[model samples]
Structures are given as C-alpha cells and as structure tokens.
Target: MASVLDAGPFFHGTVAALQAGDLLTAGYRSNYRPDIVMNHIYFTALVDGAGLAAELAAELVKGVAEPHVYEVEPTGPFENDPNVTDKKFPGNPTRSYRSVAPLRVVREIADWTRLTPEALQMWRERLSALSANPDARIIN
Candidate 1:
C-alpha cells in the first residue's frame, strides 16, 4: 500500500455533481484519453490546481457542463501522482496525488480562479493538438 506523505486540505475536480460525504473512485475516462479507463482517483492540495482540472473536465462539454471543485479526504493511503510528479519534473510541485481507494467529498469550493474565455479557448486548442498527436500521453 502507498503511504500518505503529505498533510493536505485536499481537493478533487470534476464535472459530476456530488454532495458532501460522497465517495469518488477510479475507473473513469478522461477527455484527454477517452480510450483508457483510469485506475486511480486524483486530487491536489492546491485549490486552483484542482480548478484547472475541473475546467478541463468541463471543457469536454463545450460550456454545457459545470466544473466543480470539492474539498476531499482520502479514505485510504495515497502516493504522489506519477502523471505529474515525475516524467519531466523532479518532485510533487503540483501537490498532486492519486489513490486506488475512494476520496470522500467534504464540500464544494467556490472561490478558485476560473480561466478567462480566451484562456480556456487557448487550452482547448492545445488539447485538440495534443489529442491529434500520438505521443501526448497520459502517464497513467
């Protein structure tokens, strides 16, 4: 089992509407790689970092779905998310982590910064290009 190494007011981002005490598990498909089913639930200590993830999750709906950030607690041990912690970076600078166990939602967060329309569009373009390229892979 992975050890929990950091203290956090952890958060998870997604388009799903969840209530407090709800559990988030793995096995979801990502817009970045719809062909793959993720094995771990991801979270970050940084609220805005989770905001970014929420935005990306909502981006798939092209303004139809609402992005949401939720304060969460891991139900079990977790480890640094290798998707961002390594590969090119040296440490867990993003405060990102992942686990096979469920994450319990504490509450909704409303104050995280939202990307401007232009910025969101720019990200959409980047993602489009990334999707076209076979090498732009999700580390999971």
Candidate 2:
C-alpha cells in the first residue's frame, strides 16, 4: 500500500488538522470571478491508491472514515499574490486564489468519471485496478 507521504502539502495540513481535532477553515479566491471570495472548512485530496485503501481501512475500524477522498485535476495554476510575506493571510501577500478546474465531489468511487470525460480516465483506471486488487484491504 502507498503512504500519506505521497500526498501534497495541502493534504498534509488536512491530515494534521484531523489528527489535532481542529477546525480546518480557509478562504479561497474564485477562479471565474476573481473578485469573489469563498470560505471553506472542507477539502479533498487525490491520494495514492494504496495509501487511500490503507487509510480507509484504518478509519473504518475507528468508525470515522472522514475528510472524503476525490479525484481532482487543476485546470489552471493556483493563483496567489507573489509578494506576500506572512504565509497565513491578508498580511501574507500571496494567497491561494483558485484553480481553473473546480473539484467535484463523488459519493461512489465509480462516480469520479462522471465529473469529467477523458480527463479523469486515468484516475478511473487506477481506482478500478485498486478495487480489483485482493491485497488491498477495504474495511467497509
């Protein structure tokens, strides 16, 4: 199975917040409408196949498989103010504004493909393979 080490820095923050039992809140700039600001406490991550399976198993055993997983593709670069100093806010010049492609939440793993066409084919294929792998343990 894969490990959490493979996830992005954002995933690391999410995992840390979950472990510390803290509310994860952040504001995100809108891509389509740059003037719009949105606040969110929930975020998703594209996890390594093996890592996800392992995490799902552990969480299910604990009765909390949370911070749901989803497949995402960034349509554009993450916009941020390059001049910022403080890494956390308005003081910090740079802020993660937004990405061109918005992330879609899928209830069933198979629904990942419905969000996009050929773009998500690779993720679907990988997930399908992982699901078929007998060695990958799924708690529920």
Candidate 3:
C-alpha cells in the first residue's frame, strides 16, 4: 500500500485563520502566497524524518495522500520598530523556508535503507541506478 502522511492540524489552523480574516503572508509584513501548501507539509515530513519529498510529490500526483500544514502568526515585534509589541521577538524577525532538503534526504534514505534485507536490496539497486545517472539533480 502507498504510505500516507498528513501535515496535521496546524495547516488547517492557518487555513481557518485565513478564512477568518487573518492574512496568510509568506513572511512577516510582506504579501506572498505559496505555490502549494504541500511544500510546507513535505518540509515537516522531512524534518520529522517521515518520508522523502519525492515520495510526497508522488503521492500528491497520485491524489492519494495529504501533506502536513502549519499555521504561522506574528511571533515577534515589528522589524526595526521598538514600539511594536510589549515583548521582544524571540526568533527571526522574518519568515523563511527552514531546513527542508537535508531532512528529506535523511528520511528517504532511512525509510528505504533501514529495513528488511529484501527492501534494502531493492533500495541498493535503485541507489545504484540513481548513482549512475550523474545528471540527476540530487536536490530536486
């Protein structure tokens, strides 16, 4: 069976917030929409070492899986403005796509490599084939 991963409730919260009049900007104080909510979902899955982004992409293409989602709100004071909030912003002032690629690789490799001998062998062959294709974009 194809594995399924859900991005969890945070994404739902973000969607609800958007529907409820809260703006969903890519970063703070900036208006940017995302290409897909699944990007964030795949990111979390990779971070938690659940699955590869490619697997997520495949599942997405197959229309048989749901990816993780997250809700982001103003977590800190306005940039360069001291009178913005009662407390200082504890983290980065601007939002960004956190570490995603490395974690995804970890999960994909782990999921396929750490297993029964049969799966390992299969993965080994796949890896060999992949290695032979030097033109393959490792990052993609």
The CA lDDT of each predicted structure is 0.88, 0.32, 0.27
Measured against the true structure, the TM-scores of the candidates, in listed sequence, are 0.90, 0.22, 0.25
Can you write out model 3's per-residue Cα lDDT over 8-62, one digit (the tens) per residue?
A: 2111111111223333332211101112232221122122222222233323234
Query: For model 2, how does the per-residue alpha-carbon lDDT over 94-124 read when each residue is reduced to its tens digit?
Result: 2222333333322223222122335345644
Give candidate 1 misplaced runs (Cα > 4 Å): 1-3
For candidate 1, the TM-score is 0.90
Better of 1 and 2 by TM-score: 1
Candidate 1 on 15-62: residue-level lDDT in tens?
999999999999998755667789899999999989988998997776
lDDT at residue 139 of model 1 (Cα atoms): 73
Off by over 4 Å in 3: 1-6, 9-114
Error of 1 at 116 (Å): 0.8
Decoy 3 TM-score against native: 0.25
Task: Give residue 101's lDDT in candidate 2 (0 to 100).
Answer: 38
